[model samples]
Target: MSEGISVVRVTSADLPPLHGQRFDQAIAEGRHGEMRWLAEKADRRQSPKAIWPDAKSVLVCGLNYGPDSDPRATLGMGNTATISVYARNRDYHDVFKGALKRTGQWLASRYGAGVKVFVDTAPVLEKPLAQQAGLGWQGKHTNLVSRSFGSWLFLGEIFTTLDLPPDPPEFDHCGSCRRCLDACPTGAIDAPYRLDARRCISYLTIEHGGPIRRDLRPLMGNRIYGCDDCLAACPWNRFAKAGQELKLQARDDLRAPKLRELAGLDDPGFRALFSGSPIKRIGRDRFVRNVLIAIGNSGERGFLDVVATLLDDTAPVVRGAAVWALRRLAEPAQAAAERARRLPGEADATVRAEWTEAMD
Candidate 1:
């Protein structure tokens, strides 16, 4: 019998060690580019035993947070920001952690056993642990795809000293479907199951510090916070309905923020707007960086004034991206004249390069 949530139990010995090898190889090959933390914490992320020495059983839990509507529907709406559904409202790390604490406390009280909860914050290889516990298998997009909820599950884990019964591992069922791979605008999914985070729009937008690659910017469109293209392309998502988590549901404003409005946000204003949302983690400058990319891709001249003002923003990344956007919307000579005046005072090498490129 399955509750709305899927639970997986695994022993230390049954944990997925292969993830370590693959993660290591990816890090060594630079596939995990700019996210050096993955390599920094690789050892502990290998398994439950690595995180907790005395752990005998691991409980992997899946909470479905599917969106009410197709997030991809906003992709063509060039003038607005398209935030990833998971981040539109509240931060899941906070919401999920609260849920896990309550659940873990109940389990501890009932069994009188020692328990520890680990959400996305910990270096836990949750997807492998979830599959090992039989919640779902990793689809070709490298995300756990549930037959019930598709690609919209948020994973959490509990490591307990009690030796509990473990469920069988779920096997792969992606077959030959390459919809997710082909659907990536930046070709982040280079192969069936392999993901190059460097080329990933989500990584470039949210994680990577400083300016994004010049060549990849055009493919990013209006996706400001994170991308949901591959997840949206999953055929298994036909079963996904509206998410029920009050804290995780899409906020009306975040559903589609105008790029121009987002572009004009100062640091304090940005903080107030994204207060509890995960989008705030990227900070005002980075968030503005992402918005500038969307403004450039929007092919709309409405953002010219905002984008031009942002050329003088404190953050080099924001200034550089604004330069890119202005170049896209401004006339060649108009952009050149603005650059000729602004370039004299701009000190950041990256922003200077963007000005040079805009002139070209």
Candidate 2:
């Protein structure tokens, strides 16, 4: 007689595995945008066993990082830069990785040495896997939304060798609501559950390098880092509460930092401010470039002086963005004079071109 293990069957059908079929189609259509890594491991992302077949079941977990106050409430403070809630405190990758690692250790103790833990840094499709693990369903915006946690949770997973019971997949609750889609400033979310990260303000400012697109600059608002418009707009968030993780709580400094102060940061200053945070990965130039875009979109002429300061920045990309911001805030004659002053010192071909364009 075969040994019937105490295996809990979590129907993979309920979750509808992500990369196995739909994800492959999405990537094949070029919808993942500039995140080329998604295309790199196309095969592994399609199956949990493919990542580590050594085991039997998957254990998925969630941590709620929902804010006590409205994430958007501080935007009115014009001088302040609005960082996304997910980024306000210590990096979740570090936080969740520690927790999941401990959980994985415990599992390994119980099930032997065939367990692996993952947060967002793996080939496994976390959102889809979470859904399959009976956590929640992917919302219209393509983010997982839980009935208990609402849309305010961070997902982690454990791929174990033991055949433990699996949780039933949660059902979708989006139900024709387009609030997340409509709330997006850049229309990055083109359709239900489909996002083009290239145009997303969060992606462009943080993940993307080089110049900010002229057309998209005006829509960025004061968001200097990741965007929360889509996440915050969900009606299901009404039930969401403040997170239990103290490390994930909001930081007063990052709540709504002053645009002028942020624009003034040197490389060392930027490093110190975002040390334990995910924002450090973008580096100084890209971050300042983002700040310049925000200054341009602010429509506050008083910020022209701050923009002028970056004209001589070491980075051509930052200098170019500063030129664009100055032009946006300055009077025609003032802008022309500023361009003339910058034309001679602008050694970079790109900066020179931007200066000429501003003069024109």
Candidate 3:
């Protein structure tokens, strides 16, 4: 077991009747954005028994991933990209799952029970289960907030046939606290406990495959991978402890990576740099698409040349984002010259539309 795991509590496999109602509501309203998987697995995500009928208990585990310093410090550093604190090192899915597997193995040996583990891979509604296990309550930002670990926990679950005593669920402590709502760079947290993933920077940067919405690009600032503004804003973090797992600690290179350096990454470089990291899952085209948006929001004319280089990029999304960034950083004359120079040869309708939108 990794010493990084801060808390572990058990809950009965049976969940509340209204366990995943909000998820259904979010899906029905199309608030989950491009993440169709959420809706597809709606039934299985409702309860542990839905996924596995034999499961009698759930072990909810929290791994502290608190940043050594405030992760929001890089937000104003326009020339640098702000990766979410959780993604700055190795992917937590791997780290957390390893610990869960070891724990599950022990449970299986001791009780001769059937066991299965999950770490964001399954259709498990982890936050709700974690809350049910007394780890924390779902805060206004719609993330599990731990009293001991604060908002920095990486959660996983082990489903076993071993019937265990359930812990009392934690109640909401965010009474009259709207700091998380106000901290959102985009108004993704429309209401307390309500998150519209469409406007969420994390969803926009990491999940959405195509070009980002033009209106939300400016609000994203330099968050190229995921946004942590809401999570960092919670006052409960004062009690949080920095993660002790060496593999999960932040890598110095990713802390405040220069936008220009990141924008220059080709597929091989992107894969190599983000090897074993969560950022690589998005692929180079989407990753660079995010980098271009960050470049556009940087307000640094020095990035104009870098943006220009990506105009002829093979990926339509990359080309489109480059056009948007070019318009944002280049002067009217320079933008016109590049538009004239590149627009004639541009084949993708989306890239042409980006040019037109930038011109407009």
Candidate 4:
């Protein structure tokens, strides 16, 4: 019973139907694909209180990270890889956590009790909590959509012992619009609010380890990192404004970098290029693997030399992707000659197998 603390008891009816039971089921069924962490704590992810018993109410907040220009405008440039809007600058998890922590500390100082800050790192189902906090409603893509920021906002939360009056939940305004579902290149969003991460381009390129599925590779286009087709296609974004935070603004180097240049990056080069950017987390091997796939899609034979250099790469993953790119770049005879040179020295069996297949 903290002084000046308002309280609003949420009825069971006010909670999301089944209380995120469907999300749990989706994870359990392997719909989350390579994101094993989500499935590891499936039960706790459904309820905020389950994460911390002392938590009486959850304070959810949103940070608008919308770009001033169209995020999709760079796609037509062909050679450049499109990094998702969220990853353009400092990682949102680090940026938003700092903001949430400051807000939580202030609330804790006033309330004098339990308080915790959570960004994407926690198991909390942030979208539902945001909706419950009256921040926004879950849109058709299952992402929280704010009237103020639309779907371009990043969500963070503060769990506290203080019994603050809960804001009424926002109503879903998606009404009859299926743009998000229709726009998904991989059909990741099966229905209005359901997303199968296995089919999601973002999940395949970023979250999933190892080589991407053969079928999904071409569909990825030049999006080497994450896909924003679903988010960009949303009509709600018309109301969204560019983020005021300096750290979240898009960098010019990343806007539309040439695919050939990206494919040519060595380990040191990759580190220097992506320093302080979220794309650095994927490392050079995976980054090159993605670039090679994009080179194959570019239909530009100019990148063949860049792809050829990676045939001798230390990492098998990169080599395999290079082999795949060579097959796409040249006629069978030329691809076969390139594959023959690497097949003898290839250390990884998987890469050797891919090279052998290319030579045949």
- Specify the highest-TM-score model's number: 3
Q: Which stretches of candidate 4 lie over 4 Å from their true place?
A: 1-17, 356-360
TM-score per candidate, in order?
0.96, 0.93, 0.98, 0.92
RMSD of each: 1.8, 4.7, 1.0, 3.9
Model 1 ranges with Cα > 4 A deviation = 1-16
Q: What is the overall TM-score of model 2 with all chains considered together?
A: 0.93
* Number of the predicted model whose lDDT against the real structure is largest: 3
Tens digits of per-residue lDDT for model 4, 1-360: 111111112211124547578887787677889888887887787677678877777777777788878777766456778888888877777777777777778877877967887778788777776777777788889787877777787877677887777667778899999999998888989988888899898887777778777678778888888888888888988888888778888878777778878888899999998787778888998989998888888888888888888888888888888888888888888987776666777778888777776665
User: What's the C-alpha lDDT at position 17 in model 1?
Assistant: 57
Any residue pairs clashing in model 2, and if so which? 8-165, 55-161, 80-257, 81-257
The 0-to-1 C-alpha lDDT of every candidate, in the order given, reads: 0.85, 0.80, 0.91, 0.78
In model 1, the Cα lDDT at residue 187 comes to: 92
| Tens-digit lDDT track of model 1 for 190-289 | 9887999999998998899889999999999999888999999999899776777788888899888888788889989999999998888889999899
How does candidate 2 score on lDDT?
0.80
Pull out the clashing pairs in model 3. Answer: none
Q: Order the candidates by lDDT, highest first.
A: 3, 1, 2, 4
Candidate 3 segments exceeding 4 Å error: 1-4
Count of backbone clashes, every candidate in sequence: 0, 4, 0, 1
